[model samples]
Target: MQSKIDPDMVDLNERHELLYTSSPIAALPIEILSLVFHEVQRTRRATGKPMIPHVEITLSHVCSHWRAVALSLPSMWCVFQHSYAPWYGPVRPTRERLAVYLERSGDHPFDLWIDFKTNEPAYQRLFFPLLEITLPHVHRFRVLHLLSNANHPLKEFVEQLASASAPLLETCAICPDYSHTSLTSLIANKADIFRSGVPSLKYLRMDETSMFGFLPPLDSVVHLRIETRRTVPSWIPNTAFDAILSLPNLETLSLSIELFELQAFPSRGSVPKEPIRANKLKHFRSAYVLINIYTLSHVVAPSLESITMNGVDLAGLDDRPSIPNHVAFPSLRIVAFIRAKGGSHGARHGPNLQKLMAGTQNVEELLFWGKTGIEENTEKTHCMLLGTDSAPSPWKKIKKATLNIPFSSPTEILLYHQFIAAKPNLEVLRVPPRCLELPTFLQGVPPHIDLRAIDESEPPLPLCWVPGPDWLDTEEDPFLFYCRVFE
Candidate 1:
């Protein structure tokens, strides 16, 4: 039985074939294809998943027209992917693919992220060729969680990268090399190169390396993150701190110090003698489980506008010293304190906090957590929490706040009252679950606060009572304590 094709459907099929066969590439506008490619690249980067499959690349490799269109746009070829790990060893096409992408990328600095945890030995071989391919063109580079044991090759590779002048490389993040290689020689060799000046470079982060020594004077760096852990103290020289402070562009600094296992910057050595003040810094976050008085001295900067201390003590105090009124955070706008242990001992509170608040005449937000570090000594803690006896604070400009203390007392309520009194312009107040139990929590607050009602004229003051960790799970279930603020 012969199946007869309908003439109408047959003509439609013939027309489609004609369109597909004759200049299909031209039919797809370059602008439309460019948008498609951009979207694909963004998806790949965001998912942090598998590489763009070989099949996809092969599709573009299928015909001359496809290849021509794909290769014409260099931006389409730039990739910061880990899928090509299979070609870790110095293989033939790996180098070629890298070169093709680099040429296609054409002058736009590229970020290449390589993950070595998948296959160590394979990556060892792959790393060399990749380095050969990337050392010349590195705009910014990051290597995450590389585990290089005794047998792997990392030191040599790092040396090559350090020597390569990446003037445009503004950011680099290399995680702790869990591998057992000593970093002394590595840092010693690269110190001068790093100092010689990469003007465009602004942010640099490294792990397992004590940068207190051998670093050249840093006049260009503004943001620096260095980690040192469980190592011989001899590796880091105090001179590194001095060199870092000499930087002219420093605006924001984040320090995470590991005291138990890692070596501290040399105390007896020559220190960085830059003015004790940070001139342009607007934000600072410190998270050191244990910071000494010397370290605190190194951190105090006159230009600090905001400070966030997570598991850190700002001013290292002695055995129950009076809270000083001289500790400075001048332009402070927002201050957040997060608990590492619980309580505030050998830390800033009471008068010291008042002084900090007074220094920040323009402060708009203030956050405090009762428990962190040691359990607050009852007598001293009461004095600090009670705050000073005064009229509505002229210094309190707090418009937004978050209190996550596990327990609340009369002192905490007093602080809240002070905030409401001081910030006449306060538009939003966020309180933790326990803090809402305070008797006068929303005493004078108005009813019917609506975000929609908030505008240039007829501005609204809205208060948000946030739930504690006990109520908030990964799934955002609304388990909140009842409040009659609106009523």
Candidate 2:
């Protein structure tokens, strides 16, 4: 029997081929189209924006050839993002949509992000079916993020993670709505659920008090950030210190703790006697008020290169009942003090700075940030950096210095000139725009110094000094500085 080709079908195929050949983008190779899709998805993820469902559907709608190419690539349809809200009615339709993505993914590794906002009693009935579809594909999940309110059924979801194994999982973050404090403790108790599952996990971030009872293998984590709530001080027990000490390969660590007004300081008996040594640690940052600086003395990082203390109380370092004689960071190359408070003006600030800088004599860069406005206090700002005139400046070998403080007053301008004269090896001087116009101030300063005013329109430093993304907002206190090495 001879198969007869219908003239209608043959004509339709010829028209489709003509259209595909005429379109410039449709002519691109399948591999190039796949890379373009991956890059678009990657950029969206990096921006922390919501994901678009049925991404393949959007691309496939372009042309017949594009639809066939998109249907052939499973990874293009792997991302599953859905927001569950009680007001949106039943999630049965959403589950059907999720199944479509899973079927299209076909064994390719995928990323899953689910946001649960419903607190209604019927949420479990609507949400469980979606979880059932997702749990079976855990092995293929490379990134998983579950964000829910305090009252939502997170325990059930966590239980599923504990029971399942995900060898490909690399990044995981579970965050509870900020209003719910009880949920932090609840999640902490069940933290071990994913412990045995995610072997390749590297980055982890969570609320400060949430990881009390649960911790992953410390050695595998290279970067860790712990965020503290504004209402309470971050209280870490002795056992937590033990876990921190066990991290052999940890590199960067950030701790943000704020002490409550009513909270009492911890007794000396509760402080850990032994130091926590992180041999591989490179950068360490402590933000907000640290009740007892001595408590941080326990953390010894020989390889530490940068230290940032923002809004910290340096006076508390000496205010302790008894101050230790020596605290060392031998390899420190950069030290930044921003908006630090609570130190005695002439009494403790100088000695405290000297004690801190004594071990960091080799520091190449020093940054001092102060209030930046027309109504600036010269004495308070100057005292923060140079300390008392009688005391020796701690920065003997400092190659670069950034003074991000206002120089509106003559006294303030003169103080900077005096500072320049003190640092015989001083190379670069960066100041505010106001400082640059002071003709009398510029002519009197050292000629060899590389003096430059900070451009107001430029961006601020990239370090973790500011709390959030609105750091560049004009409402924020402006900071200005510059630096260079004089040969």
Candidate 3:
């Protein structure tokens, strides 16, 4: 081999050896490597990954140099996920694990998800000690998520949180018990958890609707979401309505309320007799939450860009003030109607849809998801989506149409097809795979437009009218596809 080696080959071998001797990441500065590690953890959290041993622990095991860097950076250990489930055999929250994170994190702020849920009843006794250890560091919490359900224990922890002050808490998500009979809200004594005031609080998400009473002064909140799954009467008090409209910095507001006691409530809330302009509010979402239009009418968001109304009931179509001049969205761009199941109640979601379309002239995207069934009430609903021959198209500005609705009847498909034909500016169409079964379906679609068959919940591939949807799904590794598409 030595005798056969050419001078050029020797030079090539030496270069290859030099390249293989050093790691690509080893050349990167410590700061850049830290950023990369942080990005990996962030992506995992964003994707709902609550893995074992923490991602920092895995990074520390890569090599001695990496271990040194990971241990040196307190931020690398600040996010502690002490979540436990029954599936992980023999893997539970241990004192040593908690101690390691607390000691390594040092004075750095914490992003904690304390989901110590276990099937065993005795686990309650084991978790309180852990919470007590964590309670002292409450002031350093930047983000906190506490998950507990109806059958699990919470009185002990809720009592502890009632007096705890989180000065640095900016985002908090509380998933309380889902059952109607159980304790629905975390605030039992109506005490604000953050006694020192959450001036830094910008985002709060609550699963139960009854948590409104214990909510602290939300003047500084930017994003507020209350997704109540209970079918009981969960009315938003006049005070709560006023609090929402008065938020000067509120950018997004999502509410999911039941329809049980909506009809009995008054049409308007007092005090805000005049329209309060929500200047900073850009997105408004309501799911089956029939707030008195007369009350919410006072909230005029001229800067609103997106609207998502699901199973909404705007009183009745014949009712007064369907589209009040005071409630107009000139800057609106996107509209989505979800779970529009048909019936008398299903039709009510349309009047607001009509009002929104009539009120705006710049709607650029429209999504109709989970739209099913047919009934007497759907007549107006069909008209609202299909448009009339006599009337001009108001959604001519719509560039993308996401059709997650099924066409069981030919008339329904025709209506949707007509809706598509009317929009000359429609450049992208996202339909379900079943739509391809019909040969004539989208046959008229111009080759210039990107037509994708994807699930309603998933986003369409961003290819320039070429690489099919299958290409996006070809790579077995999600990271490779993500990099190929996004990078």
Candidate 4:
């Protein structure tokens, strides 16, 4: 049986559409209407995450008028997510679809994320053609992320991308060859691939980058991160260290490269006669980077405001920086000691800690996170910060300290009383309250006291306590920490 169209219902639908169009929002200018869609795009993009096409597609499908407006905004169509990863839901667009999106993206810098993990030859049928199509427009790329293995069959393709001049490239993250290729095999290296120059490049992250001799274009990078998970010692030559420190724009530098030697700037056989200054660097975080005393003497970050060191000696008695910590990091305000192993084995671990902290005159905050290296030595660290007659006091400038040690031992639990007793001039101290039996902890602190309340009108207290890591259950779960402000 054929269905019959009802004229009355059709007329009702037409009237409904007409009434919706007459609303105040529908009368908005095309430019203003575009912003509604643009905002949907910008809200997520501003977070530095990959933009999904669903929003743009949904908005365009709302109506014919909306479709035209969505199509008009080039940036709304700038992202090409080509992936086979389970996390990204596999975005395998045909060559025709990619070409259309590229043309519609206008001259705006585009972002391309390609993750091809599978090694099957038949699965990569479309990847090669799409890659070829994007090559001609590499200069227009703003961010290019290529995720693949060390011996990915498309290495030559990536090598071609390395040679291409990406004048507008701002961030590029890709796995380097990772072939365990050594410096002696320099001929097999692709470190100098961006030889054509990526002038606008600001952030560059890669793996196994120690084999690189030098790249003139690296001076433009502002944030450089090199992380390798392998146990092989990364050969960071003095020439390389000197070159990296010389980067005038380097701001946030992180290196997890292996440091096997103790020499200051160890190369084939050379060391910097004087300290190399990373004047523009503000934040430096390392894992096993400052293992040796001579390593600290080679580079000084004058503008460093924060430092995070892993596997470092909490007691820097024997391996004190050739230059005192304060001298090397004058602007440092934040310091975090993560997983620090002890240096010299002796009594006065507290004094040794005080000595280790002598140079942090300007430090305002300290975080002792992870109990791996410092769990057994917490009392010593706490005693040093508490400041006994023998050990010098913590810097007067320190306003906050966090003890994130997940300690359960009866001996370590006693340190809570130590923190409560010490008048270290800290306004706020965050401790894991679970360490203290909740009832006993509650009895210790006054109920419903605001730490921020004490000010000029009210006399200030020398110290205050707040439960940290935000795990507590009370009547009002949000602000239910029984806090205290007292010396």
**Predicted model with the maximum TM-score:** 3
Tens-digit lDDT string for candidate 1 (68-143): 6677776666554443345443345556766766777676657554444444455567656665667666544321
lDDT of the structure predicted as candidate 4: 0.56
Q: Which one wins by lDDT: 2 or 4?
A: 2
* Residues 236-310 of candidate 4: C-alpha lDDT, one tens digit per residue: 444555666668899877655553233533333356677778889887766553432333456687788776664
What CA RMSD would you report for each candidate?
9.1, 7.3, 8.9, 8.8
Best of the two (1, 4) by TM-score: 4
Quantify all predictions' global Cα lDDT against the true fold: 0.47, 0.57, 0.60, 0.56
TM-score of 1: 0.65
Clashes of 3: 0
Q: State the RMSD for candidate 4.
A: 8.8
Candidate 3 residue pairs in clash (backbone atoms < 3 Å)? none
lDDT of 2 at 473: 14
Worst 10 residues of 1 by lDDT: 471-480
Per-residue lDDT value at 315 in model 3: 35
